[model samples]
Target: MTKNNLVFETLPLYNKQSLEELLKNRINQLGDFSFEDDKWYYSKKNDNPLRKEDFIVNFYQVPIQYKNELKYYALLSTGLPRVIRTKCNKISQFLKFIDKTYLELTIAEITRSHVNAYEYQLRLKNSATYVKQGYYAAIQDFFMKLTDFDDTPNTVPTKNINPFRYIKEKSKRKPIPKKVIRSWDRVMKDQDIPIPLEFRTFYWLIRSFPNRISELLSMRRDCLKSFYSEYLIQIPTTKQSGGFIQEEIKTIPVAYSGHGKYVINLIQQLQEQTEELLLKNNIEEDIRTDFLFIVQQWGFKNNGDKPSVRYYDQIFHLKKHKINALFKQLAEILDFRDDLNQLIIPTSHQFRHNAVTDRAYAVGYTMEQIRRLTGHKNEVMPKHYTHQLIEKHKEIHLGIENLRSSNVSPVEFRGKIMNLDERTTKQLSRDPRRYLTWEANGKKGVGICSDITGCNPKGTSVHFECYACDWFVPKLEYLKDYKAEYEYWMDVVDRTSGDTKRAAHFENAIRNVSYLERILKICKNGIEHFKEEKLQEQLDKFNTPPVWE
Candidate 1:
């Protein structure tokens, strides 16, 4: 065949759909292709030609040596169908580039300059930097595999000569802002606006649960599992691990606070609706298990049987672009605008970021705890979410330092104060001057006591609780420590929301700080400086809780 005819026959000319079908058919017919029991097998196909068209028909086919290498690499390497398809496309593109540019050049004869030229062409064709980088990496991986292939007969060793190894990949997406998240939540929950129930529930789950959009869409009726009184959803992870496409499960607990109830109710309702629909359609027992989320759409089919079912599959299952478009449409409908009045478009991944960040800061979850909730194997991603929290904590710490600069004299203590240490207690027992006279059990006894004893149970040891104890006195040196303690508690109160045990603890600490402040004011002013009622009123005003929402 002529060079032009060879190029037309060997090169991939079809669209994505046609290419996928062609490759699938080729792999199934010529290779050991088996997908039984939901498991894929390509072991025997590793050494076989992937397609007869290139091996038999095309004159300028991918050199048999490189073709076989690529076939084995594609089969042996584990990735999702989409990912594998992308890899095949990248390899085909690289091979075509070589065949067109240097017709006589063998795979071994290709060098860094030739690879660089291919990348340059890719850059011209694909405007996205990340896309260019991805294509380059895939091509590099192809060459690397050729070098590792020990059973190579006519292939060249190109593992050590990877040209695209130094190329950098830049992130084109940014994490969603907290303001947008709050606004989106508020708008979705607004009953007057009348948003779709499914969309509301979908976004609610994304906000409340740290789950990927895909995981949420893939949820089944049996996903929910009860543990004690709490509920957990077993999610099948879509990420790849090791060299094989091994499936993994991530269990996410159903939160009892915030909008957790709303999420649970929605999932339960969806599950029930799916079951009812299946029964009504008289679906077979084997095909009755349906995805949790569904919607009415044209051209919908069931179990490869007939185009009868209108709502068979999950609404957003594997439809990431559509899901993102829906979010944008929701934003438009809600009139979501940033401070500058520009349209605010939200992405599905943003919900994941918002969930992780909210848990890290507002919920006061530790990094490890956030990681567990987010299904992250390490602290890196959790840290990224908590970076803003860390900055806020630093500001709070600085505020504490500024608040602790007050100068005050130490309150005079008539009786020696005993430390909690055993040695100090022995010394207090030995010294009569350290004891305060008290009448107990019809006998005049020497013991620790003060005019005010309303703070704690009698005879109980006072430690850090001194801030709330009326008998305890403050000193100039300890004033800074008191301010620091007060500021820390206030910061915690500001970050925490809803009715949680930690929020309650922070409120209690704030109350103690108010008590300490009252005492300090009294010490600054002499006795009878102000009316008792007026002082009490002022203390009440100071202790009023600040509204967070």
Candidate 2:
């Protein structure tokens, strides 16, 4: 009767063969029908067979109604092969779940209830929080694409349908402890363990430079540039924007000294070895020009007539999982353990975290400075990496408070035992300068003046030369504040950029803080004997009072 009715009438009778043909025709139209030539090609004897057919089959098994939807999605994601493959797998899994549960694979059958059920099932299977969240997001993206497609009939509403809409995924990755890093470094340097050259170089490079694994693995031969005696490396960061993989190149200095090993030298050696291997195997000109890192494959042959010639066609590159596994293997070999004797397996990302955290705490690098090294788009990420350091600093603050309370004694001025009254104690608590008392003629006294000129005499913004002045008196009760100020000024000096005047100011402040801290420590250590002598001297001063001024 009608065109829509006619299509709906024949939809139930469609079989698998016709569906396969339809998918094939659609894929051919999209210019992806190279199944025969695109199949796995083994360049060497031990190379793993490519499994493209399995992906192809998964793509075809997607319902006929959703075929064009997948194509549209592919068009939107043009060059990301890895993303396309992963999304396709996620969609295929959802389709299969629908087929087994509802006896139909059409997208129209998907509803909010079905999504909730799927999520519940995933949780029941003990899937990771991120895994469940990723699947939910992928499915939501798929349905959103289908809703926007021109040819597809509206089966399910895309808006406000995500089952995990409010769910948040906490990152499970933790920073590796500094002790573990030291242990790993020690194990790598030990000659008896037979560590691979590439692994050792990679560990140092990643730890020192803070580059991502992908950036390091994809480095080219010409990435390094020399400026006189110093070398700099241009690292391309692709994941900063969180969208399409776009390269944002960042230049980092190659340290020649204080790094224990020469990074630039090791890189040059690796490049030379790669070139020699490429020449020996006669690799293709394009590959030789493109890639830098390459490994020679070695294994036993049946005849054993000298090991098979190393081939450039089968160049080896370490994947993310492989790098992680290698770290785990190294951890096991080194017998690295935590305080509880739990084995500590470090991840590749931990090196980047360690680099950021250690720089933030130990080297006093500012967030902006760390951003330059880490290729972070903003200060937020660098601050997040330093969360542990912030916590540690808080603990130090608590310890400082305890140290001040336990160390400081009561005040003694000149030859008089200054008794603590509520008002005087409140004044001292409000401003530490209240403890400084100047006696003009042994009886007439004035309180809290670093100089004879009194406070803020010069109308300056800061207290100039107060801590270093001879008339200045630092109460041991405020020693913690002075120590904290000292640390802050030191950090300021370290982070000051190219401004000699400002750096000098911070350095001077640090010196003053240090002087005050040393004085307070000396007074605190001998407060008991000083208090007894002051009490005896006060009795003598009372017996011989000075004339009134």
**Model 1 alpha-carbon drift over 4 Å, by segment:** 1-61, 82-140, 143-150, 153-156, 159-169, 172-180, 190-196, 240-246, 255-258, 281-289, 297-318, 360-549
- Clash counts per candidate, in order, are 0, 0
Worst 10 residues of 2 by lDDT: 452-461
Clashing pairs in 1: none
User: Model 1: which ten-residue window has the lowest total lDDT?
Assistant: 452-461
lDDT (tens digit, per residue) of candidate 2 on 1-549: 112122221222233234334434444433344433332111221112343332332356565555555654543432234455567667767766766777744565566667666777777877666676677777766664333233433343232444444567677867777777777777655656555556666776776655678777667767787644346665655542222223445455433443422567677777787777767775543343455566553222222321122223465654556678767655655567877788998888888767544432222233445466568876443445444333433333223223223243333344222333453344333223223543311321223333211221111112332332333444444445555655765465445322322322332333434444544554465466567877999998888867883
Candidate 1 lDDT over 1-549, as tens digits, reads 111112112212343234334334545642354321122334332312333222221112345435645565564444544455567667777887887888867665777677668867876783566676667778756654333223321222233333334456686656566677678767767776545445566787777655678667666677777654346666655442222233345455444433454566766776776667556654433232456655433231232321122333433222456578767655665555767777778888877766654543232334444466568886444445545433443333223223222123113223323223443333233322213333222323322323221112111112223333333334332344445655665565455422233332333333444544543553444222324546999999889887872
Q: lDDT per prediction?
A: 0.47, 0.49
Cα lDDT over the full model 2? 0.49
**Model 2, residue 23: displacement in angstroms?**
17
lDDT (Cα) of model 1: 0.47
Best by lDDT: 2
Reference-based TM-score of each model: 0.45, 0.45
